[model samples]
Target: MNVIETAIAGLLILEPTAYGDDRGFFLESWNRRRFADFGLDLEFVQDNHSRSAAGVLRGLHFQDPNPQGKLVRVVNGRAWDVAVDIRAGSATFGKWVGVELSATNKRMFWVPDGFAHGFLALEDDTDFLYKCTSYFEPANEHSLQWNDPILGIDWPLDGLEPQLSGRDRVGMPFAAIATVA
Candidate 1:
């Protein structure tokens, strides 16, 4: 796997080497030993998958008390995945990075704890999969406004309006959220 580091301290974009032929293709999405070599000694307790139609926006969500570090990827279609730093006192606080993930690209994004994470489906039936380092705690989950002007996330909405959930629609503005420490 080729690891690409983002501007933020721990965020990473991973490209797994794929071996293919006329028959099919093979790649290891996660290998403990290999990842540890890259200083990612992760222990995932949960795996989640969601399928979204074009224009669906799921988050800018995180768990405060039980923060989760996520390894996310797209398996069926394309998505614009984003992460924003919310670590208190960090130099890059409020800074964000966006990357395109798709079945064709086979890229994975490592969103460490202390960040807000979200994705925009660019095509129908986009399958998003992720491994979480910590179990989800709904009571501790918090959402950051996806369109907050202060954060200024450049979501590739084109002309289509983003379809958000009730919780997301009422997400807190950047100033309102408690920064992760």
Candidate 2:
């Protein structure tokens, strides 16, 4: 797999090497030694999967007390995935990077701890999978407003309204959060 660093510190875009023949294709999605060689020494403890339809937006979510470092990929369909730096005292705080992930592209994203992770489905029945470094802690969960003016993320809305959960719709702005490294 090729690990590509993003503008934001600690974020990475991973492209797995695919070998195909008449039978089909083969690729090693995750290998501890290879990931360690790339400077990602995370020990994923949990795996989660979710499916959403086009226009569904879930994100800008993170846990404070037990932050999760995620390796995210799209198993089916397509999505516009994003990661935002929220770590206090970081040079790239409040900045974000986005990438298009799909079954065809077979791209993956690595979002380290101290960042908020989210994604927008670009196709119907999009299946998203992720490996997490920490187990989820609901009590420490927080959300940042997806369309906050200060952040100004250039979401490819394309005239469709995003479907958000109650918590996402009521997310707090960056200024309202008390971040501590």
Candidate 3:
């Protein structure tokens, strides 16, 4: 696996080496020992998968008391994944990173705790999968406004409008989000 750091401090972009033949290809999506070599011995407690239509936007969400560090990838179709650092006092706070993750690219994104995560499906029936370092605690979850001007997330919504949930639509603005200690 090739590990590349994103602009944010702990955020990483991973590309697993794939071995191919005339028949097919094989690659290890996650390996504990290999990751530990890269200083990432994260324990993934949960796996989540979702399929979304084009224009569907889910999140900018994070847990407060028990934050979740995520390893996300696209299994089918394409998506524009984004992560915004919300760690108080950090130099990159309020800054975000965006990348196009697709089945063809087979790249993985590591959005560690202290960040809000979201994705926009660029194609219909996009399958999104993620491994989480912590169990989800709904009560501790909070949403950051995806379109908040201060944060400036450049979502690739050229011809279509973003379809958001009621909870997500009412997400807190950057100034309204409480600082984490």
Candidate 4:
């Protein structure tokens, strides 16, 4: 596996070395020792999967009390995955990085704790999967407005309109949230 660092601190992109033959392909998606050697020592406790249609946008969500470090990948389709730094004292606070995750590439993104995660489906039916370091706590969940002007995330609209959920559409702007350390 090849681990590449992104502009934001603590964020990483992993490319697996796939072995393929005429019938199918094989790749170790997650190996504790290998990941640890690569500097990611996350003890992922929960795995989650979701499917969305094209134009569907989910998130910019995080849990305040127990932030989740996520290892995300697309298994069936394509999406524009994004992660925003939200650590109070970090130099890259409010900055974001995005990457195109598709089944063909099989790339995985490591979003460490202290960041908000989201994705926009780019294909008819997209299946997204992720491993989280912490279990979800609804009472402590928060969402940042995906289109907040201050953060200025350059979403690839490309003449297409995004379909947002009620919760996502009503998310509060970052300035309104009382982020803790």
Best by TM-score: 1
Shift of residue 99 alpha carbon in model 1, Å: 0.3
- The per-residue C-alpha lDDT of model 3 at residue 133 equals 96
**What TM-score fits each model?**
0.97, 0.96, 0.96, 0.96
Q: Please, what are the lDDT tens digits per residue for candidate 1 over residues 3-76?
A: 99998889999999999999979999999999999999999999999999999999999898889999999999
CA deviation > 4 Å runs, candidate 1: 178-181
lDDT per residue as tens, model 4, 1-181: 9988999989888999899999978988999989999788769899999999999999999888989999999999999999999888889988999999999999999999999999999997899999999999999898889999988887887988799988899988888753543
Number of the candidate with higher lDDT, 3 or 4: 3
Query: Candidate 3, which segments miss by more than 4 Å at Cα?
Result: 178-181
lDDT assessment of candidate 4 = 0.91
Off by over 4 Å in 2: 178-181
Clashes of 3: 0
Residue 36, candidate 4: Cα error in Å is 0.3
TM-score preference between candidates 1 and 4, better one: 1
Cα displacement (Å) at residue 116, model 3: 0.2
Worst 10 residues of 2 by lDDT: 172-181
Q: How high a TM-score does candidate 1 get? A: 0.97
lDDT of 2: 0.91
TM-score of structure candidate 4: 0.96
Native-vs-model 1 lDDT?
0.95
Candidate 4: segments with Cα more than 4 A from true spot: 178-181
Give the least accurate 10-residue stretch of model 4, judged by summed lDDT. Answer: 172-181
